[model samples]
Target: MLYSYAGHILVIDLTTGNIEKQELNEDYARQYVGGRGLGARYLYDLLKPGIDALSPDNILIMMTGPFTATGIYACQKYEWVTKSPLTNIYLCNNTGGSFGVRLKESGYDGIIIKGASNTPKYILIDGDNVDLQDASSVWGKKVSETQRAIYEMTKADTIVCTGSSADLPNPVKFAGVYDGHRCSGRGGLGAVFGSKNLKAIAVMKPNKKIEPKIYNPSGLKDELSELIKDIKKNEVTGEQLPKFGSIIWMDTTAQFGILPTRNYQDILTYEDIEGKIDTTGYGKKVVKSKELKAINCLDCPILSGHVVIPDHGEWAGKPTKGPEFETSWALGANLGIIDFGHIISANKECNEYGIDTISTGVAIGFAMECRQKGLINDDILEWGNSESVIKMIGKIANREGWLGDTLADGVRSASEKIGNGSNSFALHVKGLEVPAYDPRGVWGMALTYATSIRGACHLKSWTVAAENSKDYIPVSTEKKAKLVKDIQDLRSVMDSLIVCFFAGRAINKDWIVRLVNVVTDFDWTPEKLDEIGARIYDLERMISVREGITSKDDLLPHRIMEEPLNNGQWKGKKITKENMEIMLREYYKLRNWDENGIPKRSV
Candidate 1:
């Protein structure tokens, strides 16, 4: 008996229209655990080096962990693993929705999708029955429309689909896959879907649900009780997040002078735009509507998602999902716009079109900066132009006009195409756009962004909270290398467990190890878990290395390193090249990687 696992993997080859069930490898299950770690293990063994991410040979794995659908708090996430069409390297994007739970209940730990269908198709997993069905009827539809249509046709409990952005004549490289509002929102996995001529995946609720047999139900119950208490008592997971969603960080980021503005040309202070774009501002402008409310994933304690009805805009009175802190910053403050309604509308469009909000915002911000510098000759791509931002969203989604088509390829490729020193401020690390947090104010994030395997992702090693806490100095580079390395390893474990990142406050290493021990009957210590995390992260790095990534790729953008903040507490501060090198050297040494950022220990 496999405790806390479905004991099988569903393999689908779209080209051959074949479906096969392979027994889950018990040894791999124990070694890699599940989700990101397991997916990476499989991908490393199956994928050849230097294969085009959009080719039929590229594989996509949607994996659920042991804790998934086990009634564990915040264990609702599943990972989507593949070579990113945007970054051309290893990508592991995770999301929380009913889809993962339903997928698990359908009796498969994960689904490995390979080969390409000659025509549009959708995968239907209805209990024991699985088939590849023609998707010509819904190929060009938006995400929500395709989801609704698929649900209507099959009564699927959960459906994840790519929107029209992925189906465009020239698909947006930053396109994402959506399960309602929850998204695998980074790394252009949706473009990969479009390349395969795959539109959506629908999983129907099983007639007889497959629940993982817990090794110690009573012990698991006690641990869960403690976890719940921790969650309810902790200030972040308990009060702030639940009350303000992710927008609460707006106040913190602004107060700390880390609020990225005008494509990171400047950082905003609290006094600059306090009640306009901060938490209080969001509450007044966006959350005031009675139709707007906080929502949560399955068994999650923190209600971080907001469904809002904008008071004014084209989307007014329409109950659409609101933007998180990252999205708000990307679409609002980053572009020099503060109108909450416009930001909301922009976020809604991005979601509907199945594009990454972060990448889209940064791409537009890059264009706006380019226009200011006379590199781009377009008047519409100007800073603080909310209407223009909306217009560009449509253009980018459809690959409309020159500006739209160029920006659709992401800032890195866009800068290369429209060169005039634009690459200096592209604001990306390893081809992926940096998230809301400006590493200038939080020095630890400098290392975080530079070394993250999937590119400038905050979740991989979120040093912000720790660096922002009272115990640590936020601007100092001292000890940041160790801090980043430790956090990265821990996050690798969390992603493998498929636990929600927001729950990190309550669920520490001790708590996680306890949960795993009870559920899977594994006698894992905190040290052991840390080792496994390091191993998983190393394997992922190896995959990237095999694809030609070197120490040169592990770098911060020129803007982040060269340009200093002009205002606020962090004035004249920038993550210098010297600082980045010191951190990188220390990080590489910690990971047992060579000077070239290649793993020294063979997997």
Candidate 2:
């Protein structure tokens, strides 16, 4: 009997309308653990090399870890692994919601989706019964509407669906799949759903409420009690995040002089954007709605999710999910929009449209910069134009007009199409748009973005906090490679365990090993867990390598490498090509990869 897992994987081939259930491999489970690691293993075996990411040959794997639905705090995440339509490389996107828990209750550890459906369809999983049903009724609806329609029809506990953006004739490349307001919102996985003609996946709570068999329930409980104490003691996890939400980082990043502003043209401090878009300003302008209380993921202690109503603006009194730090920077500062209400409204639009806020904001910001440089002739796409930013969101979602179609493909493709030396400033690595952080301000982020397997992502290895610590200089490159590699490996373990990254603050290595031992009955040490993480990371790199990733592709955007910051304490600082190469070389050496960034060991 599998202890903490559902012990089965459901495979669906849309082309043939075939569904099969395979027993979980015990050896594989122990080696890869679960979530991103398990999903990546399945994807690497099932997917064909050199296939277009949106093609039927590209497989989509969603897996849950042993920690999922096992009464583990903040273990609400599940991984979505596949080739990215945006970056044309390995993509693993995870989300925190009730969906993973519900799916686990439905008696499956994961579901592997492949092949294109003949027509629009949605997957319905209710306990032991699973089927593909017609989705024509909800085909072109927005995310919330589709979710509502499906929920009413099937009475499922959770529904994850793409919005109308994914139903377009040509889907937006940065389209996202949403579970309620929370989303797997990067790497264009939703576009792959469009290609497969998949509308939504609805999972009903099992009639019997299936529970995983815990090996040492009492031991687990005692450890969790101690962990709860640690979580309460940690400042980041306890007070700041719960009270202010992630927007609390707004002031911190600004103070560090790493806050991205106006498409990376400059870095701004809280004083610069105070009372307009700063954290204090957000709190003053956007009040939590009386209708909804603060929200948190399943079994999470921290209530970081906020639902707010703007006090003033066209969107006044309208309740929406409050913009987090990344969303605020991307849609507010990066696009030069100061009004907190406008940022909230734009965030709402992105959620409804099922588009990535980071990529969407950066793409629009890229266009704004292009227009300023005469590459784009549009007058409306000017810096600080909130109205234009909101308008462009609609255009990008629907792939409407020339600018819409170009930008919908993402900044890299948009820059390529609007060529006139615009590619020099195109802010992407491996075709994925850079996130909110300015790499020039923190030198470690330069290497982080360049080496990330999924593309330019901050979550892969968030070096900002470590680099900002007193022991390390944020601007220096010394030992950054080791720092990044260690964090990346640690994150892999955390991600595979499928725990919330925020929860990781309290759940350190000793806690992780103890939890794994009690839950799965595995006698795992910190070193063994570390080895598994490295193995998983190496396996993902191998998958990307098979898809043509190499040292040349492990690169930062030209702007990040060449453009020096003009404002802030780190003024005149830039990550030059030589600096990047040195980091890459050291990183490659640490990973036991060749000079070309390929893994030395054969699969």
After superposition, candidate 2 runs with Cα above 4 Å error: 285-295, 310-316
Model 1 vs truth, CA RMSD: 1.6
Q: Relative to the unseen true structure, what is the Cα RMSD of model 2? A: 1.5
Clashes of 2: 0
lDDT of each: 0.88, 0.87
TM-score of 2: 0.98
The residue pairs in collision within model 1 are none
Tens digit of per-residue lDDT, candidate 2, span 185-242: 9989899998899999999878887777888999889988888888888898898777
Candidate 1 on 177-252: residue-level lDDT in tens?
9876788889899999999999999998899998888999999898888889999899989998877788988888
Measured with C-alpha atoms, the lDDT of residue 551 in candidate 1 is 96
